[model samples]
Target: MPEIAPLLGETLTSPTAFHAPLHAPHEEDQWWRSSVIYQVYPRSFRDSNGDGTGDLPGITGELARLAELSIDAVWLSPFYTSPQRDGGYDVADYCDVDPRFGTLDDFDALVGRADELGIRVIVDLVPNHCSSDHALFQSALAAPAGSPERAMFIFRDGRGEDGSIPPNNWQSHFGGPAWTRTAAADGAPGQWYLHLFDSSQPDFDWDNPAVRAEFERVLRFWLDRGVGGFRVDVAHALIKAEGLPDWGGRADGGSTEGFPGWEAPMFGQDEVHAIYRRWRAILAEYDGERILCAEASIDPLPRLTDWVRADEMHQAFNFAYLHHPWNAHALRDVISSSLTAFDAVAAPTTWVLSNHDVVRHTSRFGLTDGTPRGGDGIGHGDPQPDLHTGLARARAASLAMFALPGGIYLYQGEELGLPDHTSMPDDARQDPTFARTGGERIGRDGCRVPLPWRADQPSSGFGGADSTAAPWLPQPEGWAGFARDVQAADPDSTLSLYRTALQLRRDLRLGAGSLSWSRPFEQSDVVAFLNGEVLVVLNMGEFAAPLPPGTVIAASTPGAVEDGLLVPDACVWILSTAG
Candidate 1:
């Protein structure tokens, strides 16, 4: 057993400093070194087919936008076969595309097109579980005792009454029990199979060799299709609590939080990096210059370096920002901790503000809904207005995300400053969880709503022929106000800001983890940062902070840090000098 060190001084004590590495850090291929990865939720991107569902062809057509912006890569959500249980997150088959998304050929075409545009293509890989409709589950249901398929799914020995119940105490992410009896046994009668998410998405048993082999095959399938790399979904969740114990927590404990009697590993587990290393080996087979930005949260930096060896997942998402308070101290502490981990792990990092899963950034900084009253634990709160206040915070966040070290992932609509539209009628809920779980889960439908491609066009220029005529979700009121068309023309628009930041990242080695965050002084309202030599200030309050003496590099809102008393809820800037 490794000796635990009592971390003292500037760093926290830890059992072991993260040093895992699946692949060596690429100093030369800086394309993704500190690249800002912008995620595109296909359904919300342009709808090319007019089927009301975003497809591969549409992504291919829009590849130029990312290339022109010099975004290192585009992380597309699962276009694979699925029951759409969790917004195309549940995979029905690893090798095929769901018809609703288009054909495998279409995927190939999109990949080819993205490559042509110099934009790398990274598909989301959901390996933790598969759609209940997946053939492997069905085949396993038919397998006799000791059959390989039987070992694929977590089918455990049931105790007591109706064998339909599982052997552990875990809750499904969607709701209800985690285990359900498989009645369609080809050889065996009703037995139990565990599902951490929805009944339709059953967890895969990584303890089994066959299961591992099958997953390898699935990964190779995409690599063979000329994919740059993969965005591992719930990467650490690949391994479950070996001892199925009841985890105490009303909030979906069984899924990962519900470990009864044990260490109950959740997001990132120690044994999981080995699996990532295997992926590294596979990608190397094709000489692919790609990365595996793990969708890991909790135990991320514990073994950060280990995950991105010359071989494992290249980067893991630093969610410190997601979990931190909306204050300079909180942000500073999170970044400081992150830097320590990055230094310890020797592995690079992936940073994110908003993704398909979380609430939009505009809402997080008291911009949108202003603030959620109490932890009602309901939806991510109503539409966050005060755009005046929110927009400033957003600009600060953008500068911070871009200036910080590692790969930064921008949500699809973030570039345009789209806020979640909470004004939708109650009956219009599009998320299955909201419809099934009463909206507390805050399903991602609002952010996943269709993209507004055209400003003048009602369909946001996505489609006018059916799909464009009627989007999957209603557009936010402030959307057309910042549409791409309008922003494309306005040099000061958010889109312009996004492009400028990305360009600076590429041209200047700012993507490299060379950021030295200046100590954030307790000011009136704005938070500031010294990016290299330039001080980036963000205004969070309604009023502007006085402009501090120095040349201003950029300002999110009309605010400045004068004499140290910064403005309210806005970003401020000052250039750095060798002196």
Candidate 2:
């Protein structure tokens, strides 16, 4: 550990100069409070030119599908220019679309088509870091030590005699050292720069005025381009502890796996609130209730809501709720606590079951005694996923999440009940975690394989019908069973379940409502709650339970209630008069 020293720039100070209006005086509607947004990972969504990788045009072509799914908005993952080191998280340019995905014109066209279908667009904003190939980083590498260009990044002199070692013991989110040694123009080992993620992505020094102003400008550029909002990546990480002191061993990127680093110097510092306060003011200048959804993985649970206070971001991902296991007690406790905390701040809570960075919930639920862990080591060894059992629990979980108050996010292919391709070959793996862990971990590739569109067509119809190019991440042969075409025709499929639930959620006015548990019951195996007019019940136990008092309106599994009994591992939506 290194001794604490004064921070490089100014001592943390108050942001009283920043004005965040509590009320949007001219707001049209706060749609995000109840919006069901769907997340689309650009590289795996669809291939328009048959280049074997998904692009913006492909997404534009699929807007009708999203309209059919009844999503209020689409949160497109990074389509920005990138080296693809971290699946576009390592951005080389914030303003332009990557040629691999499409041109800037193509992106504008995507927004146009989605708008025609009444779907808002929320583009991802990667503020904490940038790719090494980014012009700013390139200039930093070419500049001399202590130069203004270098000041934009966290460049520090190494501790050792020859300055060959890293400035600190901090580790990267992927693995290994967080600081990577940079070379001078003469080929000598020079200073080290901070990269909390992969070496290809360098962390920005928020202490620098240039960095702060740059991001604010980027936000306005997109807002002016007609985007509804931005999904902030690593929202809690822009601010670091005073001296960058060590907390524990390397962190698993913001996960709260009983680790001491959950509150470490690297993440969730109090100063971060000031940054979002300024951003809220920026959003206030816009017409729509433009939002900032924090992908913050803060712990102690309550602090997650802090990012969503009236003066700050509009929503923060409910990571703890998504990480809970299938146990009824645990799920109920998390839900109650989450709703209570967010209600106190008057901020909407966001629920998400699957994202591009984690194992698909279907495969995760399939694991026996599944404990929700991060994307490392999930697709490695045996005890192969029991797809049958996993799909059942996932369907039930979807209904339960939809019934909760506040907003919800649907990851691509989640509606199709796609399980993680646990058998992806080691050679095909691309997640930074896999390489950083030296094959000890399989990473998140299992969940990112291109989605299956048509069952009989080549490329699973992810591209054109006769295209011979394969998807960037190969789809498994078994994927045919879960293809969108096949599931679209099956009324009993998970796709149908999601569509029905989403429609009912809107029709029943479920989102933004209050949630309360049902009256005391003897069967602890079943957890039941009422949100608006919908009564949601989930039976996690092995045996069937008596159905709650309600009219069965929808169910995850067909015939979930037979002979007035709710089957185990099932969930149902009912219209009940009882609270």
Candidate 3:
């Protein structure tokens, strides 16, 4: 294989511009309203240096791949300088890149390459917490209780006589107590600091003016470097309620019938909106309609819309749609609710299925129950999913999702029909959730396996043929069959389906169109919707359904329409022939 040439100092141009021609001149600034953003987990996307981990240079090399899929932008997960305690979410420095992923120069090259391909770049911003090794945190550790450094974080005295007990009963999202007692100058247990996640990641004290001002600087630092925007990680959890009161709610936001909703002390505080309003103002100062997207997991679906108010964030993840079961009625309800809620706020709904944080939808849809597994990821001892069934459902789901009126997010490698490494050995797992839970709850490592680009290459071509180390997470042997090269050659493969769907989506202006349930199948297992002249039909029943009245333009399964009947677990896009 050949090395990817350095994009620096090169004359960048879009020779194969796929999306620019499709967008109307008046719609240039509003591209994100109906765009397709590809989420690239930097560690698993591609490795250019033959190192086990993927780097910015590798992502710069793959800009063409995203352009080929008609993607509007690439949303990169955290590649910030970190201790790697929580997959790089534990940020030690907000302004620079980690050595493992490359330097600030490599990041600039990636932004340039993406610009040349007519695609925007959205980098992850983690403001909720910082790595324990961060200079501020380090200074806090060494400073006295009333020092300025300690004021930058949430530090409080322990409750008990010996100060051994935690200040509160709050729990960590990973597991156990959310507070960790730190040693004083004399080396005895002292002030306890709050951490919503692992101990290595301490939650920031948003109440502090310095913390807010620091994040403002960080935001401008990236925006000035030509990044189009940011995907604010844990967007809603940045500000906690006053006094850090203890409550009966689950720390992870899982349902407890008696717990509070939007007013929860730990998350979804009303004060967080002010932070975003300030960030939005900073974004407005820049050109090219820069954006801010929230990764908030607020409940009731409607509450999540608050983050995307007119002057705040431009988009918020539709997690309700992602977690809904595969049932037609349930899916319809989620779509309806999401559209209604987002429309009220005049914001475009951002649709997504699989991301880096959860189990892949392929495996989730394959389960016998046909519902999300929640946090209990599949392990070797767990019941295996039916891959065939899952892939079919996933393909069908993609067609339906593309035809919806909103922005969409595609997780890397889902286009290749990859499933989770459900049988990965326990000893190889690296996710902090797995270790914090003592292996009782399998972590997201299965879905974060490095992508395979070639069938016959080492590590399936993730680190290239000359790679000196194995991938950070082991790739399953069967993954060779799902390599991009293998699927790109098969017209009926999922990769091909995604390409076709994206092309049609662009040509027909489906993302900007309206969606209305095909009246005939509104109450049935067949989900049929009309997007302008296009009619998308998804058959989720056990038997074939009569094909809707239109000419079939594309289908998830080849020959999906047989004898004028649509097969079960299949989806089709139809061109309406009626006047």
Give the best candidate by TM-score: 3
Provide the lDDT at 110 for model 3: 94
- Model 3 C-alpha lDDT per residue in residues 437-547, reported as the tens digit of each score: 999889889999999998888999899888879999999879989999899899999999999999999988888877766555667787876676677788888777776
Ranking by TM-score: 3, 2, 1
- Of 2 and 3, the candidate ahead on lDDT is 3
Tens digits of per-residue lDDT, candidate 1, 211-319, equal: 7898889888888888888898877678776666666654332224444322444334567878888888888778657667777645434444556666677787776
Q: Give candidate 2 regions above 4 Å deviation.
A: 1-29, 253-262, 369-372
TM-score of 3: 0.94
Misplaced by over 4 Å in model 1 are 1-29, 161-165, 184-189, 249-262, 265-267, 300-306, 367-385, 464-469, 519-526, 539-548, 558-566
Q: What TM-score number comes out for model 1?
A: 0.86
lDDT at 95, model 3: 96
The 10 consecutive residues of candidate 1 with the worst lDDT sum are 9-18
Question: Model 3: which residue pairs collide?
Answer: none
> What lDDT does candidate 2 reach at residue 268?
82
Which ranges of candidate 3 are over 4 A from the true structure? 1-29, 577-579
As a whole number from 0 to 100, the lDDT of residue 156 in candidate 1 is 78
RMSD value for candidate 3: 9.1
